[model samples]
Target: MNGCRWMLAVVLAALPVVAVAGCSSAPPPPPPESRAGRPDRGAMLIAQYGCGSCHTVPGIDRADGLVGPPLTRFGARSYIAGELPNNADNLQRWITDPQAVEPGTAMPKLGVSAIDAQDIAAYLYTLD
Candidate 1:
């Protein structure tokens, strides 16, 4: 009876330490979602496509441009380049082929792939 009680007390004493160690050893939590529960993949795509050359995008490195309007709050905006609606589908379409959306628009067609466009749109929507 005494041996059992000793073992129980030892286990009880180690419970808090074991719990703390287990939690501390676990991997860190993932980064916060930027938009629509998706991770921030748009930032990389923005740089890869040289988007900063024409527009000033917030949170993107070296995304300062004076030719086009600043995209600081693009996510909150209602329209894309004053033409198409500012939804995911529209954004992807615009990014994939800008000239198709507006032939006369200054934004050229960068030939961005559909997947890259989607990721870019995902990143752009996080500007809010």
Candidate 2:
């Protein structure tokens, strides 16, 4: 009985150490936003461009406009403006030139620069 009790106590005492050893010791990877683009900057640009006036964008203040489709879950969407495939490149292109992608799209050419478009696309992808 004494031997069994001693063994059980030893095992219990080592349990915490064993559990900790099994966990990863290295730092975690960067977030998807960082790898994809500057989502933070994108959000700011979206507001600056008055995108909220047309689309109901999450995370942006007063972004509850009903003119265009809501931008919720934009990251999970399969298409952009129901035309181009929803990818970072395609999104940037669409943002920069909506008329070029869809000739009659209600979304006008906002004159978004390439770098700004990249950041906006990055921010939209974070909606997922």
Candidate 3:
């Protein structure tokens, strides 16, 4: 009975330390605003230019497009137009200068400015 009481005392003494250690490892709450990264702008420009008229986006549905490839899964894509890096900056450049990158993409120069293209990219990255 004495040995059992000693073991119980040791366990009782350790309880508070174990509880404190558990709390120390706990993660803090996330921030209210999700500003982990900058939003894409090129994708926003695509919508503004009405590129959806040809390509199929998750939210957009229209006919008379057929002028370019679909962009529903562009974020997960490995390459832009199957060559350049599939990222916001590259996408913005592609949207602003398709002919410059592919040289024969048949995607006309829509006169999209750099800032507008970035806004479009910001919108597009949200798709994922």
Candidate 4:
């Protein structure tokens, strides 16, 4: 009986040490920094606004639609909206104000903000 009591006491004494040793929690991950002129963020913003709802964009599935041509080779394409250059600036301008770039088109003014348009251009740049 004494031996059993001593063993139980030893285990009880070690319990607090074990619990304390396992008490620490790991640190959280760092936050991502925003870049105003960045494209991936733009693409993300455009996506968030549901641009993929009517257009075909790679790297983002479930946003596919047959209404517009897929912009798979956007970087390689020479013309956007069939008139303006397919560069970053042009893409932003076109996204920000598509009707202004194209006199008459089915593309409606979704009120996409300027920063979002720019970030979208950055995402399009990744197609290259």
Candidate 5:
């Protein structure tokens, strides 16, 4: 009976330590927007927006139009439309309003919302 009581006490004492160790071993959670711009969602949005009608985007069905430059390996590019630097913010801006970035550019203003633009940019970045 004494041995059983000692074993129970040991087990109870170790519970909190084990719980703490488990928590400490886990990586911290990422920021809210860290994964908000998911590539899968972005791809769907691109197809829904008919972006494939102009740019040939990989992994999207019927994205073979030649009106605009092919988006293959777009993530490796250094610039957007050969104008603004290729980055998340710039890409979002260009997607939301192309004319604002370049007055005479052929790209039209699709009026994409900020979140959608972010998702699209995220998907584009995966092209690399």
Candidate 6:
């Protein structure tokens, strides 16, 4: 009984620290604005741009192609196309002009405007 009580005391003392650690490890909540691209618009743009024709994007209809890499966990990726950093700006650049970012890459320049690219990137980032 004494040993059990000691264990309980130790657990109680460490509870707050454990909770803090858990919160710290969690990803920060997204900003409450349209800055990161409209997730809804991004989804629409993904379909409009035929992105599913090559990449298997989650949550998009008929996005089950196998030519390009699956976009699952795209938000978690550290880099884009193994070249540019995986960021909103870089993603926009890649989407609007893939050849300029990586010459000879299979991802063709889709003529995505800057805003549309942001929307697409925003949608991709939500796939965590």
**Candidate maximizing lDDT:** 6
User: Candidate 4, residues 9-59: lDDT per residue as tens digits?
Assistant: 999999999888777555533322223478657667767878788888888
Model 6: runs farther than 4 Å from truth? 1-34
> Looking at candidate 3, what is the lDDT of residue 64?
35
Order of all candidates by TM-score, from best down to worst?
6, 2, 5, 1, 4, 3
Clashing pairs in 4: 39-122, 39-123, 42-119, 42-120, 43-119, 43-120
Q: Which ten residues in a row have the lowest lDDT in candidate 3?
A: 29-38
Candidate 5, 1-128: lDDT as tens digits: 99999999999999999999998997753222223488899999999999999999999999988999999988778788889767777888899999998997878888789999999888888888
What are the per-residue Cα lDDT tens digits for candidate 1 across 20-108? 99989977543322344242677888888899998998888899988888988777887888897678878888888888988888888
Backbone clashes in model 5, listed as residue pairs: none
- Best of the candidates, TM-score: 6
Mark the 10 consecutive residues where model 5 has the least summed lDDT. 27-36
Provide C-alpha RMSD values for all models, in order. 14.1, 10.5, 11.3, 17.0, 13.7, 7.4
Q: Report how far off residue 42 is in candidate 4 (Å).
A: 2.4
After superposing candidate 1, which stretches have Cα over 4 Å from the reference? 1-39
Model 4 alpha-carbon miss at residue 123, Å: 0.2
lDDT-wise, the better of 3 and 5 is: 5
Quote each prediction's TM-score.
0.68, 0.72, 0.59, 0.66, 0.71, 0.72
Across 4-59, the per-residue lDDT of candidate 3 in tens digits comes to: 99999999999999999999996753221212334444444556688887777665
Better of 5 and 6 by lDDT: 6
